[model samples]
Target: MGSILIKDTTREERERIVRESLGDGFDVTCGYDDAGIDYQQYIDGKKELRELNAEADCGFVVAHPEEQQKGCNNI
Candidate 1:
């Protein structure tokens, strides 16, 4: 597994980078920080939004930079 730090970046860019890095046979798991918002509420809101657009698996979280650093270390 590999990870990269993205500052002031868009979701599309992140997704593209992940896809390219993992190649065609890998499953991607995306983690983010919630920025201190209510997790369930945000998830519900995202579900509703996705329902409106026929999308799926939409939500976010505020990730600790330290934790991300640890993840990178593990990699």
Candidate 2:
């Protein structure tokens, strides 16, 4: 119910915001980590959510493949 801007929130708030927004959506595929988004920057107040989201939408993010999981389809 308040501003989530880096300057408007604390580190803990930023952590919660990022986690809640990305909850259950983090995986080897299509994940912020795999997409090379430094979400930690947001938590550190060095970057904003919009910055990260923009990177994800620009279609130019580098992909880092994760190791294959045995018997795991992420289901």
TM-scores for every predicted model: 0.30, 0.59
Q: Give the C-alpha lDDT of model 1.
A: 0.37
**lDDT over C-alpha atoms for residue 11 of model 1:** 56
Taking all chains together, the TM-score of candidate 2 against the true structure is 0.59
Summarize candidate 2's per-residue lDDT along 1-75 as a digit string, tens digits.
899899899998988877787785553233375557778888888878777766654455335446645653232
2-43: candidate 1 lDDT, tens digit per residue:
333334334555556545644755434432222222222223
Off by over 4 Å in 1: 1-5, 30-75
Q: What range of 10 consecutive residues in model 1 has the weakest lDDT sum? A: 33-42
